[model samples]
Target: MIAYDLMKRLKELGYIKEERDPYWWPKSGSFEVVVGAVLTQNTKWENVEKALENLKNELGSIEPQKIVEMDQKRLAALIKPAGFYNTKAFRIQKLVHNMLDEYGSFEAFQKRPSRSWLLAQKGIGFETADSILNYACYKDFLVVDAYTARILNFLGYELQTYQEIQEFLSDSILENLDRIYELYGQEMPLSQIYARFHGKIVEFCKEHCKGRDQAEKIKELLV
Candidate 1:
């Protein structure tokens, strides 16, 4: 399907209003994107933003070494707003330190690897790993997000697990990587696209899909 057609359907379903969510911030680096993915689980982006800002102020930087070297307690404090601060801090520290110890530097870690290797990291689920690879490393990947899930589920598609969605989308775009890249490029990199896409879905769920009645109607459209 054409990208415009998909966009139109999403807009008509009240999933992608042009005016309500106009901002997009593309990701800059792999480590930074991974940090975000870890911090974002079950939390508001606004809170994540606050925590990230605090981390920057306290650590003097967001580079892997800094994150690895930060005091666990203090680091947890800085990222408290992101929730589950203790676990997140350890996760972030381990990820950063692992990258440094294994690869020696951020540039080394940027090297592309077999998909199996990516799947092996702790807290590195398909989405988080793909976000890091596609956004931070500029690899061609079709990111299946919460919005994608809601829209697909509404269409009577039941992705039993995240892997199922990943595999389906991966297969759908397998022969069309270039086209996928172009469509995704319109939202490019991953950060801005992710922020806008996530924000749009969250807003739509809050406004239109809050109850069973609305949700059922929305799901009917998918059929």
Candidate 2:
């Protein structure tokens, strides 16, 4: 199956560093993950991390209520490293307000983060929504970013839409859960598998297949 093959090839190549065990994304189910999901739009993860650290230093917390109560100017200044600071700060405030008004708290929001609800938010797109779902809420939605699309496209999987790629991955995963269990000697939930898959693709792209020459080198390594 494609899932098994992809996972095996990714493992044999060892693209991700050993430090990120189980997965390579940020710490799951935390406010930091949620903020990072939004902050990382159209920017590098390194920039988002700087913004996160800045926010932590400024407010001592990234919680929803704290974000809501903070002055918009201060919030924007703290997250300036993320780029599009004013817009991102406004979006985060709006997200926090929505959480408080609808779900009462981040804890409650994470309990059942509706995909439609997330998509309806001001700054949320498909990839961002799914990142919040999987990483922040620990939900089963798999994120398909540019890296996922590029690698698959390079490998001759030409999908037209995000839904197409998502469904393809879901189908592959459904057909290969048994193989995952067989290899790991334990049952891996759909969410965990999706998280790890997304993380691995991100790490692999970041480290190995960057530009065309880098991609060719990766192809050689794989062979």
TM-score of each: 0.74, 0.93
lDDT for each residue of candidate 2 in 46-82, tens digit (9 for 90 to 100): 8998999998898887888899999999999999999
Question: Which TM-score value belongs to model 2?
Answer: 0.93
lDDT measured at residue 156 in model 2 versus the true structure, 0 to 100: 63
Local distance difference test, candidate 1: 0.64
Runs in model 2 deviating more than 4 A are 18-23, 213-218
The CA root-mean-square deviation of candidate 1, after full C-alpha superposition on the true structure, stands at 4.5
- RMSD of candidate 2 to the truth, in angstroms, is 1.7
Off by over 4 Å in 1: 2-4, 11-26, 113-115, 171-207, 216-223
Best by lDDT: 2
- Scanning candidate 2 in windows of ten residues, the lowest lDDT window is 15-24
Worst 10 residues of 1 by lDDT: 18-27
